[model samples]
Target: MTLREIMRYAGTLYSANVAASVVTFGVTVLISRDISRADLGIYGLFQAYFLFGAYASSFGLAPATVKWVASGAVDDGEFLTFMALRLAGISGLLYVAAGVAYLLSFKVLAVALFALPAYQVFSVGLSAARARLWRRREALVLVFASLVTSAWIFALLLAHHGYWAPILGQVLGAYSTAFVMIAYVMTRNLPRLRWPGAWRRAFWGTALPVFLGSAVFAIGELADRLVIRHVLGLADLGVYVMALTLFNVLNKPVHMLSRVLLSHFSQADHGVGHAGALEIVRINLVVLPLMGLAAAAVLPWIMPFLLNRDYAQAFPVFAVLTVVILVKAIELVQSSVAVAQNSATSNMRAQVVALAAYGMAVFFLTRAFGLIGVAWAVVLRWTVLTVVQRLDLKRRGVDILPSHLLVRASVAYLVALAFFPIAPWFMGIAYLALGAVFRLWRAPRAWRLAIGRAQN
Candidate 1:
């Protein structure tokens, strides 16, 4: 796809993502305000555990589908069938194990295990659409799922269902959308469900490393919350989770871009060496840091209305967490590049090292500084991951970002965070205006080159 096409799709996907984030944010606000802090913390833990289980059961099939389909290396129908069957079998075993172990409440376990196969199916279906360059379909499916889930949650809450409301809503929405998407794909593609023997091997070859990487990464993602809950108790965990909930708004665009880039980069002849990678990095450098600044600036005003005064202390931690977004945006691009180059194992190794470091950092940091320390620990992990991934890309002869860009963006983010407590709106507007100027200065040149490439 041309850069113009990617931008168009990015806009659509980001809009859908924004809508989903808004709905999820509303749910977060409702839970934070109406529900007790301890219950909110339990909800947080439920989410964490469900994500880990879902990712584990997926076994990296979603990205594997994207990579194979985008690269024209596998039949979509065959791969989809394989994935569905595998996910179903694994999820059934997971349900049995959960039942035996009593890992979560019956409500939580039902949603986590039963809904997961459908969710993974939906995810793979969406990835398949993305791989086929069906951007609108991809966006629509995601929007549909998120909206349905949010509506269900709202309805359940109104009906006076307690914490189980959201979980049940999620399960209902996931299954409903999964069946719809599956039917759509069957009708649209008429994909034959034959096993492609060699391609099946090839898929596992790519997916296994990613599965290990993602599994370990999932653990790391949950580590902060788990450690906080264990070390500081549920109230502090609720506070930290609230901060994360707010920071997720900034993360929505980054997630959307990663999906677009993974598909685009996988198809690029030069992979990460293509000019598009550098353009992506440049765009993110301006957009992400400014987003962090804006969040820090506006969150103080918004928190009073959105959250209870009990969560008042979470705002500073939220501000600190925004910087993690900038670092994470960079890492997202790097990991996408690695995947594009079929060097997922290298990225996996980097993540393993980063996760270990993160685990240790979160343990000590939470002990020392409480909630803020947890935010700093996350920042430290992402920074280290960014460095490692950058070096990996450099070794692969793909230096998409200059060292100065990263250093400047990091410093700007810190300065914005520091200033937020003193002059929230001014710092926010000032940094956002600077980012706009930077975009205006750089975007035209980038687009010219992209257009020139496309024309040639």
Candidate 2:
């Protein structure tokens, strides 16, 4: 796809994603305030398993789906046959593993394990939708529908059931999306249940490294929550989970944007080549700082209002997480290099290293300082990731954007950091104004370019 088409698709994807994220955030705030600490602790424990499931379920099928579909390996019946066999075999084994765990009363582990392949199934369909391109609007619709329904479920559960409500909503939402994906596949007339025929080799060969890489990545993030539970106790785990939820909200906008952007990059001319990579970086620089400023300004009152008054203490955690986000954002810019080079292996390897760094940092830090040390560990990991990836990308001759832009963006971020001590309300207003004016300024040019691109 051309750059303009990519941007257009990204914008649409972001609109849908942002809507879902906002609702999820709102629900999270409510849960954090109302749910008991012990319940939240249970939730956090389960979530680690869920994350592991998410990583495992994909069995690396996501990138594989994206790769083959984009490469036109599945333009006919044979490709579909191969994919169906692979998914069936993988999903079957996964379900067996999940059933065993569930029957054993390993609820957290079971839920997470089952959810992994379930999530992967959903991701594969979503990736297929992107590959098809014409299916983009439909994919967004399914996602939005699932989000709205999930939110409704959560709200109802909160009034009647409390802790179980969020999990019910989460499971329903996940399955709802999965169902939509399956329907999309059937309707598209892709090949269904053909002979397995070399499917294992193709699927396993691609997924093993990616799976291992993702496992490490999962451990990096999940270890923090696990540590909090073990060292600091479940109450602390609950509190930290709430803090992480808020932190996730802070990160979601940019992350959603990044996902949409990456989908485009996956199919980019020359596969997100140097110039395309630079353009993506430029857009991120413009968008992410503004997002950070906006987050800093509004989160205090937002925390109290959305969650309960009890969560006001989470503000410091929110602040630390926001900075952690910026660190990761820098690393993402470098990751564009790995993506463009068609080296998922390299990306996976880098993630492994980052995971190890993060795990070690969290272990020591949490032992010494509790939550704050854990937070610091996150910051350390992000820093290490950025530096390590930059060095790796540079040595590989894949430095897409100029160093000066990086310097300027870093300086801008530092200035925004100065606004933290400002009253939340005032800071929010200022950032809101800044975002408004920036959007207004860009509108006329953006419109003209839109017209020009269309006419061309």
Candidate 3:
């Protein structure tokens, strides 16, 4: 609401993310350089499985916790106790699944990826404890653990042989992240238990719909990998995975920014007096495009250095994905509004439409054009989702599209793209220059608004 509060929220997110991103980006760059394309692809397949398993394990409880916890309607200790129980149960289930997959076939390791879930559940517990304490710094510690562990494992991977590096690195990192959270909890003296009521409500209220939506979301996201693995083999999947990793980076800021928005906006008053929705829109406008242009300029330069020359072809893939990030940024901000309104059902509907459109587009396009078509399909999917989400928000009297914001975004991106191919360093300059120009163009209005809110 206030500039201080807004900044505190933003700072909490970006600071922790900056640490994690630096480590991730560094390791990714190193791994991309050191590992063969085929190895990378194999690792990617494993990662895909891990992400799926992790999300499934959470049962959507992560996002739901942010919502319910932010509302301050429940006892912190009680909620955390409940979260601990659910997480432990989920972790146990995941281990069982992993064991079965291992016994069935080596291939099932890709689907039954246990390490991510094992790490994620503990990470979830830490996050829940942080929510209870309202301690942002404490929350950040887990991220730091992830970063350090990832870097160490990445280095180890460079020394080691086989696909096991990625699996081990990720699984070990998950464990480290969980351990940090658990340690923090013990120090805080938060009550830990296998509480039944909290578990029931959390699953019913948060996890179930989320799991359904995640499955749909995962299908759309993982389709290319599935197709590539089955059709073209691990080598082709390697190329695709390289491109996908860049997209994931581009998507992270949007994802984190959305979390910050959901955490605060969901709890704040949303009446006419609040203008919470409008404020959210303004903040997003100021934020998303600036980040997008930065990506456009930075990725091309970095990709060559990170990946093997064979993967140079993925530059275009990166470009297409940058567009996807911009579009997704729009959708993410809008989705925050839906979350703020407690309209999970509406959010689910929107995801369904986007997923269907994405799947169809990818199927047709990929069939005709191969891997490049898959990239284009991603762009198309995000574009359509942005439009649909905007319409939905408009009906709710939330205006996310600002003309001036669009103008600024277009100008900044065009300028960055022009400089991108010519000189990466120059593109960085363009980002700074354009960022300054955009800030002046907006007259520090957002900043001023934040200040005013903070003072109030």
Q: Which model scores highest in lDDT?
A: 1
- What TM-score against the true fold does each predicted structure earn? 0.91, 0.83, 0.84
> lDDT scores for all predictions?
0.76, 0.63, 0.64
State the number of backbone clashes in model 2: 3
Clashing residue pairs, backbone N/CA/C < 3 A, model 1: none
> Residue by residue across 44-153, what tens digits does model 3's lDDT show?
88877766666656677777776677667666667767766777787677778777887888653734466756566664654454344454764376477658677767
Off by over 4 Å in 1: 103-111, 186-189, 271-273, 428-444, 447-456
Ranking by lDDT: 1, 3, 2
Angstrom error at residue 96, model 3: 1.7
- Model 3 TM: 0.84
Question: Residues 342-403, candidate 2, lDDT per residue (tens digit)?
Answer: 55565677777787788767878888877878887887776666666666667776666554
* Global Cα lDDT for candidate 3: 0.64
Alpha carbon lDDT of residue 424, candidate 2? Answer: 46
Report the error of model 1 at residue 316, Å.
1.2
